[model samples]
Target: TVIRNAWAGDPYPIDTLMMYMSNMAWNSSMNTVETIAMLTDKDEAGAYKIPFIIYSDAYYSETVPFADLVLPDTTYLERHDCISLLDRPISHADGAADAIRHPVVQPDRDVRPFQSVLIELGARLGLPCFVNEDGSATYRDYADYIVNHQRTPGIGPLAGWRGKDGGSIGKGDVNPDQLQRYIDNGGFWHHDFSDDQRYYKMGNRAYLDFAVEMGFIPCAEPIVFQLYSEPIQRFRLAARGHGKVQPPDAERGRIEAYMD
Candidate 1:
């Protein structure tokens, strides 16, 4: 969608493209030659279709040469990262788990961690939640943000050893030494489900309660599977010009053919 939008400029044109660790010009793309051509494509006025690009990567990959500006990044051994539960967690069928990666060796180069750079950039841009009440930077670095930033009242990126004294789990106040605690406990946290809660989880009362407690769900309601989707019906209606936000005439046939 981004590539198409960049070239077509339909709906609106984007000013800049920022990418991190994504090698779109090479192995990541289905057609690398075509992708490279698109990235370097020019308009009739001799202007680039995609104006500016900023890319960051630890290694000088194939995509780096196409970027207008490149930010050097530290490798895994010299960076901190979180395999957060709030994102893509490392989970088993019977358990929920998360992990972290702390720098084992310092970088010999002048490169910085991509995440830390993003945090500083967010602060400098004065984005909401990245700034304090007085408009100062909220976090000193990515580590500080990871340990303190809460998505909700108690839920954070990690889910273990929470609270002031680091005795709580699933949900609690922020623990200042949470990273150290994770380091001490082998860099990962796991929570096992009871036998009853492990099976038939969608409707299991125990599982539902556990999910709510773990901030995985808003309430302990049984998850009812939908046999018919009204949202799809609405899109079909839009395709038939029955709504304000109707699909373009070019897309109407495709929508009607596939939506049902």
Candidate 2:
């Protein structure tokens, strides 16, 4: 229902939205609203008033009917992706881990990985990060970006084999054959923490140190998990006319009630 939430109010707020690997029919709340809006709405210029929706899916699904553009994405086995610490990394408390999906077979249809498409689109839009000084595309594709784009000066999205020779792990120079390294290592890479570094991760100095090495956090600072959030309290205070940012009149009551 995030798409519908983005489409809330009399005039739709978003200009463009791309759905990746999502089933809109499964969207219990947003599907009907999105369908009605997309089919019937028009702008002052006689163009479709609703946000231009681009739905992407590997299989032919019920959501295809609503898309202005249907970008056919390849199956997972036919694409390259990295499960990095940035998103939901498949890591256990014992170790920081990441994995890669290497295309096992060629796609028979005109399909591409969404990550490659996004990179190309970013280049087309001339986004500074995705373009060179001469306005050429920085990285050729998602795999190229994975190998070259450093999250920090030396650290990147992948924690696996890195460095000029593909011999190092964690922090190192970009390895051109880094993807190959992952492929060779059974499609995954892991860094196991020591016995003392396994539990009490939020406060354990050793665990925090390893987390920093793996780019999980900036520093090995102990984290205090919040039970009552100050940000929520701020929203409540705003509802009572006490802050620069104020809640809408309709939402004020709900916000204030949640504060207590």
Candidate 3:
């Protein structure tokens, strides 16, 4: 959910907020918000539905007129759990689930436990109709499910589990005891496997995750790629035949040398 932080006064127009959202890399998937509105059309009718943005501080300033029942959740202190799915391998953390996220310190507003609110919401929504039995969505140990599904070779469970004794990592690795080996070798894995079908590289594909990461495509045109390489502007970094510069200017064997 992208909640844009409103200023004290001189409130900005909705168009401004919309433009701000369109320009930023964070909310590039503008359609996700629309999709949410579309998906819960059955449930919400004309009311706003749940937003699914990675960042929560983006939707604001008269844009979401359909918003109803706003729930103000706390920062790190109020959360009883956490998640650990790093899109890039470089950002790994241990015990990503457990972070001492208890309410021992207390809050300025109504002081209530996090678990209670979740249980209440579940009862109201009537989700997971079978297992919950009461035709409600129970708090199904989301933290546990997160730890189990999002394991990425190093991070382990929150409680009742010990990390590698020899400083190795394993939870997400394909090899057995690889996690342990990583620990023994000071957090490093020596994978000996050669290139297989999994390493498939195609010149061009219908779609790619990188297109999103690079911000070359937006949610409005999720299936389309923006013209990053204008033929009018030549580039030396591009490969021989792939250079965007049109013929006679920077095409193969035409110019004395393709300048950077």
**Highest TM-score among the candidates is held by which one?**
1
lDDT of 2 by residue, 1-260 (tens): 55554445333377676787767545544557555565447777886655587888898877777678999999999999889866798988677789999899999989999889999999999997899999999999999998899878778888788889877778889988889988998989988889999888899998888778766689999998989888777887898999678767877899898776
Ordered from best to worst TM-score, the candidate numbers read: 1, 2, 3
Off by over 4 Å in 3: 1-66, 86-104, 111-126, 129-260
Q: Clash totals for all models, in order?
A: 0, 0, 11
* Better-scoring candidate (TM-score), 1 or 3: 1
For model 3, residues 184-255, the per-residue Cα lDDT tens digits are: 544332222122312321212322233232222332233434366354234433434554543433244533
Q: By lDDT, who's the top model here?
A: 1
TM accuracy, model 2: 0.86
Query: Candidates 1 and 3: which is better by lDDT?
Result: 1
* C-alpha lDDT of all candidate models, in order: 0.89, 0.81, 0.33
Candidate 1 — worst ten consecutive residues by lDDT sum? 1-10
> On lDDT, who's better, 2 or 3?
2
lDDT computed for candidate 1: 0.89
* Model 2 spans with C-alpha error above 4 angstroms: 9-12, 27-51, 248-254, 257-260
Q: Model 3 clash tally?
A: 11
- For model 2, how big is the CA root-mean-square deviation? 3.0
